[model samples]
Target: MTEETRNRALIVRGRYDLTVPERALIERGLLLADSLGKKEYACPILNARFVLMPAGTFMMGSPENEPDRCVDETLHQVTISKPFYMQTTEVTQGQWKKVMGGNPSCFKGDDNLPVEQVSWDDVQDFIERLNRQEGTVKYRLPTEAEWEYACRAGSTTAYCFGDDSGGLGEYAWYGDNSEDVTHPVGQKKPNAWGLYDMHGNVWEWVNDRYEDYSSGSVTDPESSSKGSDRVIRGGGWRYYAWSCRSAVRYNGPPDVRVNVLGFRLLSLSSHREIKSEVVTNEQVTSEKLKITSEKLKKLIRLGEEKGFITYDDLNDMLPSDVVSSDQIDDIIMFFIKKNIDIIDPDERETLIVNKPTTGETSRDRDFIAYNNGTVLDTRTNLMWAGEDNKFGINWADAESYCKNYRGGGYSDWRMPTLDELEELYKSENYENVIQITGWFVWASETRGSDAASFYFYDGSRDWYHQSNDSNGRALPVRSAK
Candidate 1:
């Protein structure tokens, strides 16, 4: 690829925002990935196809302005020092069955479907046997850095395709088009480097143990040598587009297996650069994505901390474009989803005065703590569990767990609704009344098949499906006697 062309391919924008040069470069890169001349190795035994990836540097994580970004996805530069081959698609049931002599996938039929429900330890065993058989060539899980590098495939967008999720249906098997189940591999458009299903299908396991990415530029970075959980990437068929972004990451214990968890292999071989694919001559500094107005982010945080924002606050924070004639509705809806209400300026001082402190002023608080694991709010006559279920769980399981709660030996314990969580957020003793050691807490509110969730740290509210277990916490509450 020409230095100029490689630079063009790294430029990212919304679906309708790309320039002619940008569109042309993206099309050309996909054409190259589809060409038969691209370096590819078809495994003799597993029947999996592998593509040779070029060594290059890329911005490793999401820029803060990207919509629905997580805190751990802090941006940094990473250089892959050596060229290597990654499986063209995730390992399929046929491939695992051929080597392991058994199929452990939850989604059955169509041997072409990426295998799921296999734990990281189970994959290690499969890799051990497969390596022993390959004899000359060996296979292992890619490191977290290697996985992101290969998934991005030179693009600097949320997904390998682009920033706008409207086009995600054509490129990945995610919640919108996945029918809540896994699908056959190689059905979507490949990335610039001839890789498939790098965004969604099943979460793929990486070799590195889970750790917060250390700050600073790195070359061939690897995770910690030891940890309780291993990193998982690419999201899954049940996940939405945001979760399938190239920079998105989640993790699980090595022995835990679920239908959404699976992995692909990295082929170990001597480096042989592919001329059409290599672009290492110059560093490709990606255009960091600038989506939502920066003012909106700050305002959103402010609203979360205060429980409500004022029209005056909006006047101060919203950019000209956000509060403009065309974008006024966008501004309103954005805060609505975030559970931030815009009130009159008159109410702002009242909200401020409501901020409770740990001084002598809070000695006579309405919420009373008990030696038993529960808290009683004398104001609302509601009793809440002192803590949560202590681990992440899916919406369905959380509902069941909350309804059957025996905390403080109470029989009527149940899940709190969005309104209840909002009330709790206003508590002067928030950290004391109901301790939240996790980010998200599940709520009783339901929208069709989806359920509401509250983010404790940022005061954001979201509704996810019953199946997505990531970041879900269960904190049961009931009417106090």
Candidate 2:
């Protein structure tokens, strides 16, 4: 009698044998999903179920003939060489509350419903805290290719059920049946691989910046490049069936939170126990060296307390400057080779740099230079351009210059931010610092109609006219991940 009741009645009593298109969809969908059926894993930290996805190569993006396909979804081949575990469903209200200690979902009262209204930035905090609780850096957001690879569950069809949109109701809760609000997760039938809510429920966030797909094949590709917006896949409860297609993509500002956006977790290889090795003290210490040793001890203690350093590898990790040396210097350099892949870029950018030390500072050491013509700042785990651009350029040109940089065996580089430039000031007075003396550097920050620039002379910062009127050098930086 009522509209809502009518929709529910139709859903329950609907009966139709497989159509020609439906049979094709089912066959294709089963290709990927039929094998990875419910390799279930429950995270001890959040107690949510995860499914192990296999490693294989597949076509990524969409074909030109795909109906409603966007121009950016250029078909290409992608190989996911490593297997990872992905959450069977989007993160639910209960899991978010357990890891983040709060539930921000607009659709409340159901603990099993997918959590929404969480921004990509907020998800970073959730991931960091979850890693700490689990005592391993294994959890992360899936890459765009990984997300699509799993969503397809092996099939290349538009909706993962083939090209037919009529049968989408059986596998997803989209606009037609969602009743304008999210329902509980896993209520509908799953895809061929037993993955529920892949087509609908909410827009799932992937760990990639918005970029057009390339035509060439790639192996274990990653998007380390920085951008203003991040990619979100899958459709939401309020979206039409076309938007729920497996190849569909959307992007939003990383800090923007909406009622329809949420994320799932991707678990990397299991944790390994770090083995400690004994190292004999190779450095001969004088009275002055003793004082430097005290400073090093204090720094190490602070690092341990801050959860940045583990005690297991204390001996294995020593100051980089102390390598192959018979004597030590005023500055001590501790090397921490983290699993860069597991760290999120947003969180990496937020890591606090230690203040300059009066007696012996960590910033006094030279960065680890790569054969590819880039330098690594072990202190903050950021890679920087070994040299500045010879000619000063406008802000717009500076951005383009950084993006086009091809040094260091990497392609994902961008101009440093204002705060990041300020952090570079800590390296002042160090002999090995990049020779940008007497020149101002352009930062990726805008002040009104003008851009911000940092003067290397006195470490002063100021705003200047737009790129047309003002000129400065651009120094590119990339995440070590």
Candidate 3:
């Protein structure tokens, strides 16, 4: 019998009830059986080849000890509940041209090269048109879960092959191998599922909105439909090998289109409805603003777009007469107050993810409502919940509640310090700028069994017993930076 056949036979009849480590070994072997196997489909119109992926349960996300793992990659079990056919490579320039009648890729050499410089929204448009022409809703982007499962190919290691990144050059066109440019797809080795360029080529967009993973096991898990950004997987030609790991994830606004971004296709067995979610885009600059303000607005726009502004950017946009080191420092401080960074630039660097989820905070006449469900003190760059914990709680529970708060997609909230709470009470204006519903707010400063509580009713502060629950409420605060 052929080697492929022998491996397939062994996997088909393999015992799965073995010890956890032994069963993992068997599954890894099973993943190897499908290498170059014949379960694939060819799209005649686009000349795209897709490999059939099997339904199986695998642990999603990275382990705590995994190197370069993001906090968002909460390790959990996930099942790709349905079998689907994934494009063997990212959609190529040729395929995109065949369907879209235009070549949008920055690298224009070969038709076989994976298309780059596309956005999630652009891919959605392509899919919609393709579906209309083919008369089927089967074509779509893979869910985040399915993308990881197929990318892992039953291996639990960091990369599809193993944890060692040294071997990645054989399977991916990464920064180390590609010489800082995208190359022809499928030139690298395929994963055990016969999928090519599933590691580094271009960062491929999946079909879900960006959200943190749930630590609990889930079936065919997908991201929440209510987020400002979409998840992109598989590091790009310009990215490091660790970023190209099976579990590494990053997100960008759906409308973001950069040279390192592209997407692959997945054909479903059953019909699914088209997703046409629209998100509002707030333009930074306005004509109504004065000329000087317009320049600063442009700075804001640049900062929000890429995360940080270059020193060159500031120099170019500033008034020509106001060109001194002290003047520039003052200008930088102004922008910093608005939570924008102006830093020294290395032209060699690429991809600035300024505010990953669309500057979540917006300034009003008085205060900025950080739509991430927090109120902001622009002076301190500290964010707080619009409302405090409605009921009274002991100091310990209050601390826990504040620390555990994940309001508005933020996770660093904690009990405010005594001075911080005092700042919230605008004693001069008789205003509670922080706007907590409760009268008394807990502060982190404590004296043995007593903790400080700020009273907004009269702008007074005092230490209370640690177990005090009478009119005591927890207020969560996090630094916007």
Instruction: Note the clash tally of each candidate.
Output: 0, 5, 2
Candidate 2, residue 254: lDDT: 95
Residue 266 error, candidate 3, Å: 0.3
TM-score of candidate 3 relative to the true fold: 0.49
For model 3 the local lDDT of residue 369 reads 66
Q: Pick the candidate with the highest TM-score.
A: 2
Misplaced by over 4 Å in model 2 are: 1-38, 270-481
**Would you estimate the TM-scores of all the predictions?**
0.50, 0.51, 0.49
Candidate 3: count the clashes: 2
Total clashes in model 1, counting residue pairs 3 or more apart in sequence or in different chains: 0
Tens-digit lDDT track of model 2 for 1-481: 2244324323322111222222232223212122223356687646787877778889988888988888888889999876778888889987775544346789989889899999998898778655533434468999999999989999988978899999999988889989999989888887777688999989998899998776899987777686779999999999999999998989999999899899899886321111112234343335444443454565455554553433223334343333322111101111121111111234433443632222221243646664234667776778886666544466766776676554433558788988888777776542274656326888888978798888876778988776442347767788888
| lDDT by residue for model 3 (40-148), tens | 7676557788877877899999999999888988999997766778899999987775444345678878988888888888899778645533433468999999999
Candidate 1 — which pairs collide? none
Which is superior by TM-score, 1 or 3?
A: 1
lDDT of each: 0.71, 0.67, 0.71
lDDT of 2 at 274: 13
Candidate 1: misplaced stretches above 4 Å?
A: 1-38, 271-481
Residue 236: error of model 3 in Å? Answer: 0.8
